[model samples]
Target: MLEVAVIVLAVFSVLLAAACGWLILSQRHLAALQAERDAVRDQRLKELSKRLDTYLTGSVRMGEELYELRRVVAPLPDKLTQIEQRDPSSLSFTQAARLAGMGASVDDLTQSCGLSKAEAELVSKLHHAQHPTS
Candidate 1:
């Protein structure tokens, strides 16, 4: 009876040792997977930072170009108004498109002209006064 009890104790010890070994291996595998995930996350963040830097630089360059264009066309408004007043009704399509960018409405004066939001409102009022739909 004593020998049988000793054999049972020895079997329990062997199972406990195997369980501990499996737990250690599982812990190592989990740590390795976590390390790989962290590396990928770091790489993605670096790529996003590089892309943002590139976009910001391009936007600044575009803004400078627009500023230069505005400076070059600074006198266009005064010249356009002078020509518009001379022959408002007979202005060409290109002239009206340009004037629309300014604060003028040549739509009522010339049917072929396009008007912006503000200019279109003024054109509506002038059209109503000139040719009222009574």
Candidate 2:
């Protein structure tokens, strides 16, 4: 009976040792898997951070460009108003010149734009000189 009991005890010891070794191996594998997962997570975070930084930089640059454009364009309305308020005689001359360019006769320029005959003739000559017969 004692011999049978000793054999049973030896079998149990061997089984326990095998179970302990398996547990140790499983623990090492789990640790390696966890390390790999952590590395992948860190890499993803770095990529996301870079993309966010790039987006922010571009947004800031666009904002600056818009501000500059607004500053440059702010006085355009006043300048246009000044141009619109210039001398009425100058406007008439400009009309005469445009009419002459469009192939209107000197008499037409004098009648339509209220220019003198000499001014209409000069404008017609200037237009003809600048744009000769094609």
Candidate 3:
């Protein structure tokens, strides 16, 4: 009866050791899982921050471009009124000369600046001769 008791005691001790080892291994696994979660969270935060910065920079650039466009367009109405009310015939020769320098076609010169067909053709030829393309 004493030997049987000793055998049972030994078996119990072995079972306890196995349970302790399992517990230790489970704790280690849990720690590793927590560390992995932390790393993933950090990476996601960095990526989101970078994306937000890029978005802000683009928005600022777009706002600046809008401001510049407004500045350029602010005087367009006044200039249009002046052009509409001016005597076209008075400035026809000068306007034709400038348009020819800017690569205007003969038809455009004749229509916009009231040049005759022959005069427009002469201006186109002279301007083209001055700034010839290869």
Candidate 4:
């Protein structure tokens, strides 16, 4: 009986040691996998930062071009007014309306074309008074 008890105790000790060794190996593998994942994440973040910098540089260049165009065309409105003053009779009704600042004018012949209903009514009244149907 004593010999049987000693053999059983030895078998239990061997199983406990094997279980501890397997647990330690599994923990080491898990740590290695986590380290590799962190490295990949850092590399992706650097690439995204570079791409954003490029887009911001392009946006600034486009804004400068737009400002330059606006400066170039700054004198156009005055030049157009001078030409109209020199030859007012040759200007169309819509052009006259815009110059007079009256929302409705005689030259707007097309119905519902750009002008609102009130504008059209004003234009109709002016047309009738200038050339009565009777």
Candidate 5:
């Protein structure tokens, strides 16, 4: 009876040891899985950071280009005003051309727009050439 009791005790000890071993193996596997997950997360973070940097760089470049374009275009209105002031007679010519476009006769262009008869004739001829009878 004592020997049977000893054998049963030994069997329980063996079972306990096996349970501990299995627990240890499970813990190791869990740790390895956690490490793999961390590695993947870190890789994804690095890729996202790189993409963000590229996007920010492109945005900055575009901003700079816009600033340069604005600077280049800023003087255009002033230059156009100066040109108009320099050649006031050009305004009369423009009026004469518009009168010619509206089917006004040469006499009307000369009288209304203050153009010479020769200038009125030239504006009428140019307008007819550009807009022929269809």
Candidate 6:
């Protein structure tokens, strides 16, 4: 009876040791998988940052070009007034008529030829009557 009890205890000990070993191996595998996932995520984040930096650089260049364009166009309104003042009624109406034929808005004619909005609209209407579009 004592020998039988000793044998049972030994078998139980062997099974307990095997279970501990399996648990240790599973924990190590889980840790390795988590580490790999973290590395992949870090790589993707770096790639996205690079793309954002490139887009920001392009936006800066476009902003600079727009600033230069504004500088170039700053004196245009004054120059236009000077020319219209020198030429008087004939040149402005001719210009307005041409612009009206080309689909200029009333505001465009008012700004470009110094005409009132009513006059610009009248010219636009006359031009449209002379040449109807399809």
Question: Could you give me the TM-score of model 5 versus the true structure?
Answer: 0.61
lDDT of 2: 0.79
Which ten contiguous residues of candidate 3 have the minimum total lDDT?
A: 76-85
Give the poorly placed runs of model 3, Cα more than 4 Å off.
Answer: 2-6, 88-134
Per-residue CA lDDT of candidate 5, range 16-113, in tens? 99999999999999999999999999999999999999999999999999898667656644543564466776797678767877899999988997
Tens digit of per-residue lDDT, candidate 2, span 52-93: 999999999999998986676566445433533566436876
* Whole-model lDDT values for every prediction: 0.64, 0.79, 0.77, 0.60, 0.79, 0.79
What C-alpha RMSD separates each model from the true structure? 9.9, 12.5, 10.0, 12.0, 11.6, 9.2
As for candidate 6, its clashing pairs are none
Off by over 4 Å in 6: 93-134
Candidate 2 deviant stretches above 4 angstroms:
87-134
Cand. 3 Cα-lDDT: 0.77
TM-score of 2: 0.61
Better of 3 and 5 by lDDT: 5
Checking candidate 3 for backbone clashes, the offending pairs are none
Displacement of residue 132 (Cα, Å) in model 1 is 32
Q: Write the per-residue lDDT of candidate 6 for residues 1-134, one digit (tens) a residue.
A: 99999999999999999999999999999999999999999999999999999999999999999798667556544544564566675687678878987789989999998887866776666566557691
lDDT by residue (1-134, candidate 3, tens digit) is: 99999999999999999999999999999999999999999999999999999999999999999898667656644543454357554777667768988878899999998867976776565555445581
Task: Give a tens-digit lDDT track for model 4, residues 8-127.
Answer: 998889998998999999999999999999999999999999999999999999999878866755554554455446656654434434433444443453343443445444445444
